[model samples]
Target: MMPPVARAQAQVLPGMGDGEMTASAERQLGDTIARQIFRDNDFLDDPVLVEYIQDIWQKLLAAARLRGELTPELDERFAWTILLGRDRDINAFALPGGYMGVNTGLIAVVGSRDEMATVLGHELSHITQRHISRILSRDARNMPLMVAAMVLGMLAAAKSNSRSGSDVGQAVMMGGQAAAMQNQLNFSRDMEREADRIGFGVMTQAGYAPQGAAAMFEKLQYASRLNDNGSYPYLRSHPLTTERIADMQGRAQLKPGADAAMPLVMDHAMIASRARVLSRPGVDVLRVWVQAAGTTEFAKGSPAQQAGMLYAAALSANELKDYGVARDMAARLRERTAGNAPAARLARLLAAEIELSAGQPARAGALLDAKARDRPEMMLSAQAAIAARNPAPMVGPLRDWVATHPRDATVWRTLGMLYTAQDEPLRAIRADAEANVAILDYVAARDRFKAAQDLMRRPGAGPVDHYEASIIDTRSREVDILVREQHAEEKKAQR
Candidate 1:
């Protein structure tokens, strides 16, 4: 149960070093890690939050393409996924084939939307440059020996039950290969410089402040000094040297033209504050943040920023199960922002969630179906409905969402719950299988599909059950194929 930030570096798979891996293979690599994440982490699968981030990613990517920073050789159709890592460390990383993850702490670190975009831009650059692929491609001739060393290491660990022996084996293998193969397992200074350079241009071209990258880096630098951990996650993988910081500073000063004001997207601080709350840091740390940025004693900021702070306080209080405190904070937040604004709507949703958790389902139900003509449609409405234990209002909305977003595992899971409530067990089983498959959990998905098939074998099995069973049976076989393919890849890597 270690936080995502602490676990990230160790989670990177070793010895996938064939280098001639296709774009599709790189995509599978990302999917494999993403599945592990879905299983191990408390993923913030909020539709509103997810869609907002995706919109920003698309903008940054489009700008990169316009500037000729990205090429068609890379997978243009990379199935990009932006995962929200609920960790308190400021870090972000891109997986091969366009999967990127941002820690909540990192979101809270940046001061503006432009800075956030700068971070995303940098990750996009890494993927576009194929830095990871190039790094893994080296020493192809030595892969067999490396894999052998790793296997021996595993055997030693198994025999002695001492993990350190395995660790030593891996270190020896990687270390020797790294020394002989120019240390290509890690990103080089040139790669960092290139990403920084290209990422800066991306932000500028996307109408963000030219200095956004430098500003974000300066904040990171200051944080590095304050924390001074021997292993800052970002520094471990990214290697933020002084030269890179200065290079960004210089480039940032070179503004595009007179239209270089801060970009006016949706309330960026609001998003960051929401991320901070979702990180679920302990009460002690949350208290410190509340003091510095929360609703109380935070009068010297814009209404949006203050709303953000209140949102953080409310969410933290809710997590602590202090419903009254959450209600008060959320009320203040909703009052602070304009009625129809994103911040205001989010505040209302927070309040509703608190009410639901407080066992006031009736009150929460009212919030989910707000009758106001101007009430903005919040993604949390479906979740609120679920929390209220009332699936009636959500079925139509959830169906619509699933119809348009067939691949969203989170929604499929939610829809499955609603189906169970409605006593439609067969459909629920199918939806559950889809959810499992979305994260590439072929084993779990196949099991769920089997359960659906079993349901169809009951004495009262009808035409509809039989029809659905056929589909589920086909899906199970497809999942089996995928599972076998992954096993083949792993065995190949070992060889």
Candidate 2:
């Protein structure tokens, strides 16, 4: 029982419901927004940190698929990507499709892996439920207004120079549309509740503690309070309420796993400590934090946590070329985590990084080799290989790593850097194209691919030849199609 305008907004379009946005048009829309997001924000592209985040996302995704919360076919189509925003705000968001972003502040603020999983699960639910598309459909009659707001947002983003705390001028069409906007807000709150209900289930079903949702919200509540009287960026978008916290707590209390005392599979303390170290840009800032952590109050936390913090401090010191502090602390970390299998591996990775940073590639390579003793680890061994030498000692390992992690834009970028240093311009151009493609930067990717194609056909005594030309030609045409489609969808959205 709604008026014409509201009814037009509520009516679902063909192929836009069931929380599934698998249509080709939706996919293109997602890519466009993701491109804008990356272009306007400072993103943390550290391989190790990104790997950890991807691991948690994969776990939640597996659980959701197992429960039939998501179909395997739809899963394959979603192109689920988790990216890190360099902003200090304790916020995370789900974009148009399956694209999700977490700020460094949110990751550093979390106390446990389960809490992180809860956030990921919640965001995943938002996508799976298709709340965003539904909102657009319900308000389809307001498309012109929405488009205008988006334009203003883009202008604002440009004016702010893509800095942290930029508002993006979204929702600028408010004065005359207050009543409609209020209804929209109410609808959004309902979506939030639904996401919470399903995301909570997603967390526990994945063999994680259900209490984590409550714990994280408790932290979020305090953070919101401290942020200019509860005006945290997440609150502005998510609108946290006392009811939501109580609901999470009530549900958590009923969790059997919490009563049974389920232990965490991941070393959350170490993970959070790593997040904290990488959150700050400089070694000096980490050194100050590490020094303060040794004080009585912080020292009382836990030995594992303390070891993690020291490991972070040591890694930072290594970046500052303080080899003495880095070597000693890294050695101590290995000793402290000797009994913990996973923790020991993390410490060793830290060791490899320290040695590599100090220009001791041999020592770094030897440490990882000793761990396997004979067999090698695809995960860490390949990473160590990349850090070993310029021109890269083991191209095999890098290729293997990229094959396994095809969606990792950072790794593709690293591969490109390696090829460039080796004076392999053609390969470097292709690698850069793949990196851009992974991030859905179609225009950039297409141009790079085209450049490589042109080089392949150039009449010169160079690396690229006829066979390479054929390969490049094929890739060029494929990417050209994508670019054409991308532009078409972009034009449609604007119109």
Candidate 3:
């Protein structure tokens, strides 16, 4: 027989079982919610931000897999996609079937990549442990739509933290059952504890500093002490307690000099600056960032601080149509970050982005390394090439990339533009359809796919590659089924 202490500890963890919810079902529900998100105007896919976040996210995923916490079945079945919302509320959340979200507000505030990684690792652990499934198993059961509504409501509430719990309850269509439904929406305290413990191990194993967890907790603790304004939306969902802070600090001590020194903040500073600007922090704020770059104080700051300010100023100047200032700042940024390869690369990307925005596509292409093939590079280069009417070279590379990363809606959309430039209407339509599919917009996807199919059916409709035609036909049928399934789910939810 187990000792009382051991038994109590064991009971703290949720049942390590799937219960009634299968992995596939969870993924389907996640798709439903994600489609809603994709349709939201605030959903953003800035290439620079996406690349930065994905770098940390993929590392955490690899760490989870290496530790055997992520089983092959779950890994294969889950979406594992991160969505970025442009909202300025500091929040990150895990959705069913491996979908995660990070608000730009959170990215703008974090002091280091390790701090961001800690948050992502925690969210990733929540998915790997099937926290959503376990919660549904006990409370939501077969009512996936009820849970989906509640999850969406939670997201809405998280975005606007001014909303009270009762507002969230009403938003989810739970009527006067606000208190009861709100309780159901949250993960149990035990689950939060589990996520912290597991997430700490995951982040450290992924090569992030262990101290990051402690630092993030301290930020949250500081926020909690202030008045509960809507700024710190993260606190609404992931409430901080002294015990949580103490737990992270105790774990940091166990590392014993691991990541004792602060991480080089250059890369994070640049990215966080980008996040802040991209979050649309108002014209007043943008003008301030632009003005700050030319200040004497800016000259006195450290390399990282200067790099960050330059990047933001450049981006903000571009936003404000001060292209000359934007270009000047970006060039200075590249020079400032020359010693750091990653940060330097970001500067180059920013320079290219500014040139592109300023309608100097040729200059944009020149700024990007001709030999580089990273996602952000490839994407920006593709746009530049198309703009320059030299789209041929990018076609092969973008095709290869999308073949491996089929769910990259941004790449697909860009590829469609490239195909259109090459005058391949059929291929462009197919690519457009695939882009729709990537966002889980099955209805629109089906229409585009069918349009491609119809084009292939037309006699003398340009050169028809038999293989491409076959693929389009298959995709058309697939998307048709998805559209039907989506409609059925909607009806079920309505009922």
Candidate 4:
């Protein structure tokens, strides 16, 4: 028999596992399975994907703080990824290791950031409780059964295998399998109940109305009933029941002494605006919703409701590319409320974006630079500065920011990209290397290193002897390991 580590490595591919494996063997097997799952799915190694993941993660992280569920320790391992699915199904899922994916369809359905945060918080709880890891570990004891369950679970996850990495069909298939897994899979009913109970707690703690989760589930249930069965993967995998709704209501009511004085955090407007930016049809529709909200029974019902309506309108206009109108509305909002950070930040960012889009890069640079200085730790402002035409000057500020905020891989990646843009290949390579380490993924880091070497080999490029040799040496070692793994697999198959 192979040693635990070797046996684990051998079982890296999907549907292949070491039955009754030791802890080390199980971990190796899990890593192998994860690698195969990612590889077979045609995952892209693009910066845009990385940026999108980082953006969503940051937003959720902030939401976690508002709910008081996030601590420094939790923040370190709480990473997420957004998978763009082509499916029309409104769904999302979170893996045990902080991997949460939001379908484009789900993005369409969510009317506000608060609602999305409700979803994210619920999923985050699953990871925080180590549900996925526990499930996987249990599966390792029964290899065949685990494989079958995983196939179903992955289906529930909405897996895809597309070159563009955005195929909804793949995800739908995965989601379907996941639903099936619930029936025959090994996870206990107690686990589901606990997840529901804890997820509701996280959502309310994040300052969201605990009712949002119940409302969302109700909506999903209604939608599912309206269509044939299995229309929504999320509902299918989650399996909403009357009991689940009652459970949530019970949990929500349990917190009678909850902070009633807590301010209602409004993120709907931003969500509506972002949806508009990403969806052309959604822009006009959201704009109408925003406009109707002002005078409708909804806005006239209450002061808080009216404020939310106005905010949504301003956000809609911003999404429609009506910057001047958006700015005016934002200013009005700032006047209405003394401490409207969202309104102020949105206005500032919109103004900068407008300048950049209008080909006034220098003006954008100045605005962003000043903002970055004022909010020295603001990632968005730092990113805006990095996007400026001559980001060379901003590099020093970015480096300083990174020193203080070392966990932000996006900043490191941005610095590396900026260095490359400025023809500083060596710096770019080093920055990218650091970013990769922060991510704890060698495959990505090795690719960035190769890019740096290629840049150094250009004509009149700086002395590349050391960097070039280093790249070759590092990359060769990585490639050797891959080759060895393939050889071992082949030998095993032959036997």
Candidate 5:
């Protein structure tokens, strides 16, 4: 069988525009790549982290639109979705479309929202400036396929324990055109400079501290100085230049009150700590964080530092299955961050999560307002409701949510589980199929859709909800067409 990366290259390489790739084509390519990423084990959707990142992302997007940097056509065509990865490497990248990815390690290291915004702004600028397409457009002969292969190869290699995938990627990278592959992987120095300049403006326009750009550059400089140990994968792709650092520093000096230091906000501290814990830093590191919370040094630290420590300690303890420690730390964190609404909400969520994990569904349910419409609250409450054997309350809101957000595979799966709990087999099956459809797994979606149809056709299959039955029939036809198109593409690729 052809390796997945090879198959992907084959599937997407043909009919790619010769000279300049259109925005629509670029979006199509991004969609294909995103679907593969969704299937990758490292791809994740940590609600807290996602919500935090999305806050920064949406601001950047709006700022870009206001500045006329984001054209309506491009904005409407692009995915504009940020996919989170579990990789501990400090990296973020912009794909062909507006799709960007952020590693948990990037969030774990930044000291404030401004710093995170700087990184995100840089990535967003890459998309708005059409850097990827411009590079591919420069020469179309082998560029398109080469870049696609390179992207898929890197993704494949990132997969843990996928030796075959790694081999395929290595072969592509180290092949006869190794130099070309290398060039395609990293943006040119000119493109980097453009991204830096535009990203700085966009970030500041979005109300982030201007010093953040320089500060992030300093962090990259520090990482570059460190003996290469693979902790910072971002440096490899971004390739920090002394000239770039100098430019940012000069820009920072030009800004009013440039001397003023950006303070670390309590919410950022907690969010960073959450990112750190979610990155799966080993038990040794987790234990160290837990111990730090009880130290005299921790007491002497700034409120932000203490907030971070407390958050980390609670999460680490929860990870270690030390529920009592988790609870105590969470409560202290909640108290400490009481002056900061966002941080306090995070602490409350953390407390509720611990309660649920500790098998106290009632406590978890009580911690959250059932009417909360936020993704994190809704998701957590849903889980609690399911565990408590009362999934009814979440069903209505979740159903409404999925109706508008049909691309949310996670929510669909959760709703399916809720249906399962309620013994609504037909709805459960349809939800399962929809979940697969959201991920672009048309084969699996078709199978599930067919199964639903079969179930309905069975003798004495009790009177189903007319609404659900009609919806299933419609979706079944849709998935069948998708599956056939998918097969046609595979055959085309083989040809």
Candidate 6:
């Protein structure tokens, strides 16, 4: 995994050509490549990656209204990715066909949701304009004629092996004395400017303070000045100059109306606090930040923003084993973000955990069961019920949940554990086997398999061994069949 900065700079070509291509052909090629890349990259399926993309996409769609271009069709076409790069450099990029990669380092630097949104909107505009595709089409048409000239120019710097410098020189020599290579880089600059303009519009429209965009750029410029030229790739790709600052100022001057409500300042503060909590290593440090951010002064700003801050604080306190504080913070957050599904879910889960921690498994079970009625997808309820020294009540909900979410191996595994705890060896074995079959992951499957085998060994567990063995065999066969079917489907799609 490359750092976002390195990945952003890791282009096979210095610049794409400006030639045109048939729209149909371009669309076909782009879709094909995008699908293939998605299929091949396992990282795309990661839960964290999925969540990050969802968050970014939601904000981008809201921002689109500012530009007077909020269409369902356009929203459907937009796609993105967050690349986990190995490099520590802060960077991100967006390609023509909506391929966006954000380095983990860039994630580290982002202190607020709006800051992340600003960058995402800026990159999205480049994709909206189809800049990369147009450049590629241009190169494809001109490559043949320019090959000899390019090679000759490269030969002069062959011994030095300065790839970028040679490419720049070659482009200049072959395209008359117009500094074609510089022009190519400048083209990127122009795209950046356009993106900044469009992104600000989107941010303002989405209710974020328009100044946040400029503030983000200012921070980036400041970072660039503090580091060597190569340290910050964002600055390199999206060069910031004095003129650019003035341009941003001029744009900021054009106001539609002052009545447009700005998002609560506490929103920014809370996001920053959450980012800090997540980034910190030790639970103690997380707790400290949470407590510091949840004081009356901090929570007094914006109700929504304060709610967000409290949520993070509660999460951090929970991680630190401070259930009392965690519960209090969660309750406060619930009051602020009333009726918010995620906040409600978090509060319920935290309350149940607090109860369980206090050794009141019965209370935890009751709370979870009530909440699970509305949020049937919650597996924690079943787990809580099992902890109450009873597995019968959990069986029905687990069965229903499994029916709705058959692909979730964890639920199956938990069901198996619950059954085993209740002394139902055969049922546990079967449930565990089914879980292993669905996931097709041997490591997770092995745990369930071992538990089932252990249960069958009990002296009074009559005929359990035979039944467990049969289930193991059946599930093992199912895994192979599923894998083969997936392969077949992929091959068919390729054709």
Clashing pairs in 2: 9-138, 9-139, 10-138, 19-129
Residues 1-495 of candidate 1: C-alpha lDDT, one tens digit per residue: 112221222223344544465676666666766776776545667554666677788888789878887777554656667887677777778776677887777777677777888889888888887776665455334444444344334434433535676576765665454343333345689988988888888877888776667667877787677765743577666767889888887887777642355542335666777787777777886766555644346887666667677777777777788788778887777777666476666666667778877888677767765332221233355556666566776667766766776677877888888888777889899999999888878888889988887887877766565676677888889988987887786676454
Model 6, C-alpha of 305: deviation from truth (Å): 8.1
Report the alpha-carbon TM-score of model 4 versus the true structure: 0.62
Q: lDDT winner among the candidates? A: 5
Which window of ten consecutive residues has the lowest lDDT sum in model 6?
Answer: 1-10
After superposing candidate 1 on the true structure, give the runs of residues whose Cα lies further than 4 Å from its correct spot: 1-20, 65-73, 139-184, 224-227, 257-266, 287-296, 369-379, 387-389, 462-470
CA-lDDT, candidates in order: 0.68, 0.67, 0.82, 0.53, 0.83, 0.56
Candidate 5 Cα deviation (angstroms), residue 429: 1.7
User: Could you list the CA RMSD of all candidates, in the order they appear?
Assistant: 5.5, 5.7, 6.3, 7.9, 3.5, 11.0
TM-score of each: 0.81, 0.81, 0.89, 0.62, 0.91, 0.51
Model 5 residue 210 CA deviation (Å) reads 0.8
Best by TM-score: 5
- Model 1 lowest lDDT segment of ten: 1-10
Candidates by TM-score, descending order: 5, 3, 1, 2, 4, 6
- Off by more than 4 A, model 2: 1-22, 140-187, 224-231, 260-266, 281-284, 319-321, 369-393, 420-423, 462-467
Q: lDDT rank, highest first?
A: 5, 3, 1, 2, 6, 4
Query: Can you write out model 2's per-residue Cα lDDT over 77-150, one digit (the tens) per residue?
Result: 66688768676667777765567878777777677778888888988888777775666555544444453354
Error of 4 at 315 (Å): 6.7
lDDT of 3: 0.82
Looking at model 4, which ten-residue stretch has the lowest summed lDDT? 1-10
With candidate 2 superimposed using the best TM-score fit, by how many Å does residue 157's alpha carbon deviate from the native? Answer: 5.5
